[model samples]
Target: MSGFSRSCAAGLLAGATLLTTAACGSGAAETPPGQGDKPEVVAAFYPLQWLAEQVGGSDVQVTGLTAPGVEPHDLELGIQQVTGIRDAALTVYIKGIQPAVDDAVEAETSFDAATAVTTIPAGEHAGEEGEEHGHAETPYDTHLWLDPNRLATVATKLGERLAAADPAHAQGFKDRAAAAVSALGTLDQEFAKGLSTCKTKTLVTAHEAFGYLADRYQLKQVGITLDPDTEPSPTRISEVAKVAKAEGVTTIFTETLVSPKVAEVLASQVGARTAVLDPLESKPSGDYLSAMRDNLKTLQTALGCTA
Candidate 1:
């Protein structure tokens, strides 16, 4: 196997072994990926699950609360999902990424001390009135996963925690984290190359969700719609058209979960086309690396990147 894949295998084995150790002593039975076993890991969403897997490779057993093809915003974890969280050694969730998961985590009195939770903010939207109220509930953007630079922070913390829980494989966790970071760096470079070559440095999107991606790639954003929490207004579309014409944007991009009506309307006015891109709030078809690579390919075409 390639070095990276080999490292992944080793880390997964080590993590699984560690989970076994923790589960045995606690009388928590080990369960396979599909089976809902306690003393396991429960991720609130897909990206977090994928990250947990990267750090907890074979040694940790994980289950995602949000299934594939499900949008995080509309998710409502049932009693069975709650049981999964209660039985896990850790639970990772992006705050504000999914209101349902955040509500469950907040009201959860049973698994308070057991699950490890992480929140990804919606850039600046997190500060709006409804989301933050305390230290356990603070105001912060929950989309940290979208920014590769910020993801390094989450990866570092997860690696340390996994190492602490599994001392025998501490070094292995660290090594895997390093590998993940390297892969993220490559993904970021691809974004940089593709976006930097675009004829226009500005992007018009159906929503403001791409702020993290735009900021990372040094591209400006002119939103054709409003916040993810709300839909677009006729005036907003007109304003976005003005910005698109002014900025010379080539395309109007829309995310998978959201409606494309606004993008189509905005595109027509500005004589631009629309493209679908995934925000990756749910479990993607591939791992994090592959998901990001696909996103890059779509961006290259949408933005007219030469490279």
Candidate 2:
């Protein structure tokens, strides 16, 4: 078994110890129940955590496995996080995004969020020869949260799972999910109107995490680096520069969690400025909807898009 699996198994053993302690009436060693009898949920990442909180409202105690400002693609689960997964009433995760989390969730009853929405394929920019952009061996695009409609779909499905887990709060979960869906619909409309008339239809980003958003807004995303941690080769940089010049891309966008060096280098080469186009992998200033609206303003300004 892998190290993560061993950790999870150890966590199970620890849980058993806690149970034994509880039976022996040693309150000091007992694990407390979820707050106010709320069902505990382990969310693999920020987007999933946000969805659970929105759908579950006051009825669920959600623990996010991935911390803010960390690269979700590079998360490695620790013993505490593994224990959280082993003991959660429900675990929510995107399959293939984090391998350790995937293995941990497999050992438990989980709501695979990826199944709730259709996934886009990860690939190099079309017409860019020899430029492959994607996570290590991850064939499907895992950044579904970048698109508001798909995220809304996830919220709806999460509501169903939450209702199933906590039947007494079924109506509350459904109502909150409906409200979230309506809000996402409004955000979608806003994006559609804002990007309808843009001077440039192409967006140059630091990584390939915005394909779904580009598809939704009818814009093309040219990524400077396929993997966030690895630097692009000189040839790949040349190719992206060529695309930027050809597409009249005025801004090269970088994310909060990853370094902006690659984006800055590309922007300098193409005489363009760099901007922030967050993938919403981590909560920025506010909640998911507010961060998306903030992204809309950035997109409008960078792409010269107008309503």
| Candidate No. with top TM-score | 2
**Residue 127, candidate 2: how far off, in angstroms?**
15
Candidate 2: segments with Cα more than 4 A from true spot? 1-33, 125-137
Q: Residue 139 in model 2: shift from native, Å?
A: 0.9
**Pairs that clash in candidate 2:** none
Model 1, residue 25: distance off in Å is 31
Give the root-mean-square deviation of each candidate in angstroms: 8.7, 7.0
Model 1, 1-307: lDDT tens per residue?
A: 2112223344344335434443322212233443222134566667877877787777656655565666666565444444444434565765545554555452321122112334433333333323322213534444556777667667777777667665777898899888887777777777777777877777777766666777778877666543555656676677778888887777888887777887888888999888887778766777777877888887888777897
Per-residue C-alpha lDDT of model 2 across residues 1-307, encoded as one tens digit per residue: 3212233344344344333433332112224335544556667778888888888889776666666676766666555545556666677888777776777664346888778888887746533333232244456778888898998999899888777656778899999999989988999999999989999989889988899998888988888766676777888999999999998888999988888999999999999999988888776788888899999999999989767
TM-score of 1: 0.75
lDDT of each candidate versus the true structure: 0.61, 0.75
